[model samples]
Target: MFKNLNQKNNDSIRVEKDSIGKKEIAADSYYGINTIRAQENFNISRQNIHPELVKAISMIKKAAALSNFELGLLDEIKKNAILEACDEMIDSNLAEKLELDAFQGGAGTSTNMMVNEVIANRALEIMGMQKGDYDIIHPNDDVNKGQSTNDVYPTALRIAVLKLLGPLTKSIAKLQEVLQVKEEEFSSIIKLGRTQLQDAVPITLGQEFSAYAEAVNRDRWRLYKITDRLKKINLGGTAIGTGLNTSHSYIFKIAKHLRNFTSLSLSHSENMIDITQNMDIFVEVSGLLKAASVNLNKIASDLRLLASGPTGGIGEIKLPAVQAGSSIMPGKVNPVICEMINQLSIEIICSDQAITMAARDGQLELNAFSPIIAQKLLNMLEMMKKAIDKFNNKCVKDIEVNSDKCKQILDNSLAIITSLVPYIGYEQASDLAKEAVNQDKKLIDFIKEKDIISNSKLDKILKLENMTSPGNNLSE
Candidate 1:
């Protein structure tokens, strides 16, 4: 009836619509019968899992189903159907008749149903039965027998997130290498260092690059730490902590099965109380992601500021131009890639906040917002990974330091006061710096006016390397 109406002309379309009584529905809005009625019923945010995330989720689900089947938690028939359905979703091979919404509330209840419907329908067809024949392979009883929304959703999320972690780890490692290379490349170049937005003293460019590398290293370690937390699965703690209504060996068996399927060495967390009630692990992961975003944002901001202008701003370093800047400003290349990374980092930070709130919002025994937390945090990871790749490849890899500009800035900076300490004494050097900065006079001019040192002595002490390098503590 529906197919006939869809193929009919306007006259037939109107007649069918009138006959059905206001039954016209958009396909995009409703993905056929397989879609959750509430999703069509609620129609909230149009947001759906991204394609990469969907693929990742499908992979996780298949692995989990395979594990359960092996453990005897699910029968072979149901397990095979679930695995096939996961592949269909992952490969976008589902038949056109059973349309499904990728978006639904209840932390992927819609997605779970999509999988259930697809598997159940496919299994029915295999048995030479029609679609929606729940008697053949029931969606809830047979297919989702040993699972709950809580366990399935979080487990799938962890598995999906872990998959992305591989790429994320590679990203940080690549960035670390780039920063180390920059350190070597800019080793001898002296540049003015800033503290609290004021010039402090001269420092070799290598030191600055080394700091970025260290930050990346720290983030990578933080990622590893959070991954340990994510590895502890709560799959067996179905419903409200206890494995009620499940077989005696089902929980342990399924978890072990999942472990083998993923090869992630996953363990059932010993503390079911912590696992079921507290989302500290979620918050901890969010914090690590937040730290990563902040670290990357700092690096990106510095790159953009350092590469600000050839004539106006501090053109201390140059970032590769990935895009045009201003429409009217000729030769107006911009650090668009770095800017994008900054923007994406900010969003990740915001998402981290959302995860934090969700963690705090959960009541005893079950976090109602686990779904949102999982979605937002996973999105943060994905965005952060992509942003890092862009910044590393398009911006950091080809960056060039303006040796002349660095030298000029270092020469003019009053922060060179420390260099004069050994010869003129600390009191005199400090006073000289203050005078130079306050009077807008050069340090050499201030020194000359104050008779702090003769020109020959000043020249000997103020060589750029001598000024910046922290030599043996002669004062000490």
Candidate 2:
């Protein structure tokens, strides 16, 4: 792109030319004609590209400029100006000018050019020159030295994901911690356990909560381990990963600078060409996220069931009264927090499917579907973190177990007789269970009134710990 506006007089607009042709850009605009062309050509979603991605790209530009200067490929003056411009972008809203959708053509060429143009113009201004004065700091020759969108875009994407993973895992850990606390608090509350929605036996509520915590802990570790894959970025692999216009020296220097700039353990891919051709890493990350969402969905469903009602349903626990459940009802509260998590979990699952499909459609040397994958993956990470934090603070922390209700429900359930199988014999116990249910009586009361066993023996046999655990220590 060229900007021959050095001798121009107009204040409102300036003319810039690319191979495609010339167009008038707003003189006050930081973005150049390439960004405008992209905005016009691909008016798909109209959403801004991920801000983290823009920041990642800016860091790449800064590190690339510093490496070029260090290698004598670029002069000190231009390098300093570009570095400052990149800092401003990293620290401020300079990249808000990148107004393109997440879906675009050319494997993120438009988004890459948008970053290049913004940095080049900002560098020119930092050098006391005009915004469009490419004669001093051209976007391609200087700001984007020895880089291609094919390589830089995916590299920036990896860095962005790496940055987000820390917070996401922390959120998972927080939820797990909350569940663990709940497990400890409910350890003594024996309740009727169900299988296939039918009462089966006695189980302490703590065991159910412990299982939820273990699932979340496993997800946290899975996400934490995926970092090893995200750290292996395909940078320094110019167009098509062959290092077409770059050298080994420049590639090695750039990687060192990138590591310092982003503070991430970013390793340049050993097989850049293979990394460029395959997008399996994204599919793997999405698969793990889907697994987490499945666990979260089930946990949320369980909470909703346990907190179903105060009068008619299984009121074994109470959630925080976040909001009114109905407009017409006088007094009713809902499990809106878990419901929100349920909705977001389903959305994340859907986004994972999109990522899977995108990963599968990569062409020979590149995947134009990367923009969509990046968009979905980052979105999943961001929203899931917020959802988990909300769920932990608003719902899980304030949960109250209805122990009286639990005791009543368990005493009334005939399934509790399974504990007496050894003492009364299964056939005799089965007969007593049928007799109790037929006469609308408690199983314990029916057995005691029938003089089947001494009341003191029944008390020892039916203690909560004895019924919930393996041994009763009441030998015949």
Candidate 3:
């Protein structure tokens, strides 16, 4: 779908030559010769580069232009042109022109060139020159001055990931808040807790929701902590991090300008060589994402089980009926939201594995697999954010508890004998539990028939609050 969007008429082609050979580029294209070459070479994913990355790259160029102008490296007219062009790229919604695959080779050199060429041609138009007029504003010497794909690609990736984090964190916080609300709403509704799918003890439905809320809170914290790691970028570590062909002043000044432009707490790496060689930070971030996926999968699975059936399964809760569950089965409503979240969690886990392998596969001075890594990571984050939003709005907020079902299950469970242990002794309690189960009688009724304890004392001992908490003495 994206590949066919930005194509120009064949008659409007103009011949443009590069180091290797010549190609016919669309005359109206803001991207020049190198971008066309990459577009032809990597027709793989058929998907355009992410818009967030494009915006981040343009912001980087804008910041670099301002910094270069400040350092006397770029003339006023060229700097203004580059800045205006960067703004155009940033504001434009034409993502289809960015035709390179996300799985490209060369450590994102193709990606960087695409950005540089687009900016250069746009800057040329701003200066009243044709798109291919490199003499007016060269993509290499002017637009990409004092930078290499090595530094720019990773730096833009970091910025883009940071931009994405805002929505992700907001979604997670909202989910946590909704879960907390459910926790409070279900606070007094008693239910039978389970272990290994067997009755264990008594607990309020609110306690279960509270656990989900706590898990989401932990995920939110993990995301917040990892942002600090992403902040330490290698922006000025041009080429192999030696800052070769780039002045020291430009290296420091560019990062400062970027921080001002992005409003992020970004800083240049202290050891450019290490930052250039190691991708451990990305691996760590992926690991945290995997952790969050695990939590979501677990929560979704629990919701599915709890809302399994209204007649056959453990129907302790009822999920919201958003749509029909089946095409043939009448009056069927499935836990589609939970299933969607579960599937998204699995995909995120797989993407994390891909990111891990990519991070580890980096050879020496650069990770050539960074394009794939960036795409998978960003895709997972975006999908998870949307999944969370849908899950919250369509499912979690509308969930209803089966209070009668909960009480019925709790009343029949032999696990209630646990509360009688302190008063009757463990051995006696065990015997009574077996007798109650065998005779198909309520444990409280059997104990009452045997005159084991007064009705009031039994009532106090079997209180839902007492059973769910510790330090509740049976003697009291």
Candidate 4:
């Protein structure tokens, strides 16, 4: 039932009453009393619920309507109204009107209620009735039939996460492809490879880029595998896992309708109680995201160090100059894209920690912190996707290897002494390395000065190719 507010010059107000009390709602608003209460109670984060989540929830409602119609539980008129309302919500992006804070109490009941009230009012409009006419089409009885926030919230969260993973996977794969291209481009440029911040051996620039490509490829694969975990959803398990107040036929058939509606490979969880009680699946996906973050962080750090300076530091590679690096230094350029990715990675890592704690803090039947987990996880995914794209287009693809610098550094490195040990024995090679370091001379130059071996043998032993890989013995 709805009551028009009779206050003078307040024609734009309507009265909606729940168990708590009556509240004034906007006449044009699709949401109702529960949503208003949530908006007023939890103004913690001014940010509203994410649009993807709202869309996912709308899809669930549409699927439920279709399922109820097929089961002969709901009349065709109401089903058509609900379906049309859902279509309007999705097509016109009506979720922008949902103003409840993403972080809230009641285990996402407020979020569920916000969606329900919007759909209920929109359905009433489609039926040519005024909004908040629960007597004709109740939000709980008609729109949200056979569902609960416990089931619907987590299920919608899974759908939203799966939707986001598609773009994230593509971004990561694109980054991997770019790194592979760089590997081929830098294949022949040889450089010094360092361990523990000290030169250890000779390596081609291509080999370093290949390692980065391989790491990203692994992350892409893990992202693909994590979708399987999300596919199993706990829909139709109203309240708890007992499937209380829902028909067995509805319980078994809802997932089929949801899969068809969402075009996602969704399946009903075999054990609803387990799925509801444990949010480890979300934690598992978050862990994989963390793994991807770790890989990106390491690659970005390596690029920053490699592109440290043109006159000092490694200076073996140059990153694309996107902007002026400093306000004070006139000619400075920084690896801002790499820095951005590094900072984003750190944020993703911290988000994962939050999700982990939220998952662990589950009480008895439900996890009240799902709102925060969903918010943090979605934010991380979107941020990481953009960061990867920026890093790939602006940095990785534009990386320029300094071949001259590589050769110069390699010439000065005493790490080449490793190649001489196979032929000269360990004690002699150690003495030569010490002398080369003490005299501040190249290993090749020191060897030439001492006449340790014949010129031809020394030349054969000290080949750059010999130092980088394994093959024939240097003594041979």
Residue 158's lDDT in candidate 1: 74
Order the candidate numbers by lDDT, best to worst.
4, 2, 3, 1
RMSD of each: 5.3, 3.2, 2.2, 2.8
lDDT for each residue of candidate 1 in 1-476, tens digit (9 for 90 to 100): 11321222333211112222444333222122434354465465555554544454455556656656666666777677667666665666332333333334565566665555555555555555655556666766766666666666666777777877878988999999999999999998889998876887778888899999999999998887677778876675667657666665677767766676666877777765467767777788788888888899899988888888888988999888777889998889988898898888889888888889888988877777776777687778788888898889998989999989987887787776777788778987787788788989888767777775777767666666665555632332
Q: After superposition, how far is residue 56 of candidate 2 from its true place, in Å?
A: 0.7
lDDT of each: 0.70, 0.87, 0.85, 0.87
Question: Per-residue lDDT for 58-80 in model 2, tens only?
Answer: 99999899989988989999999
CA error at residue 18 for candidate 1, angstroms? 27
Model 4 residue 436 lDDT score: 85
Q: What TM-score does structure 4 among the candidates reach?
A: 0.96
**Local accuracy of candidate 4 as per-residue lDDT tens digits, 285-384:** 8999999999999999999999888787899999989999899999999999989988988899999999999999999999989998888888888888
Off by over 4 Å in 3: 1-7
Which residue window of length 10 is worst by lDDT in model 3? 1-10
Ten contiguous residues with the weakest lDDT in model 4: 1-10
Give the 10-residue window scoring lowest on summed lDDT in candidate 1. 11-20
Candidate 1, residue 101: the lDDT equals 36
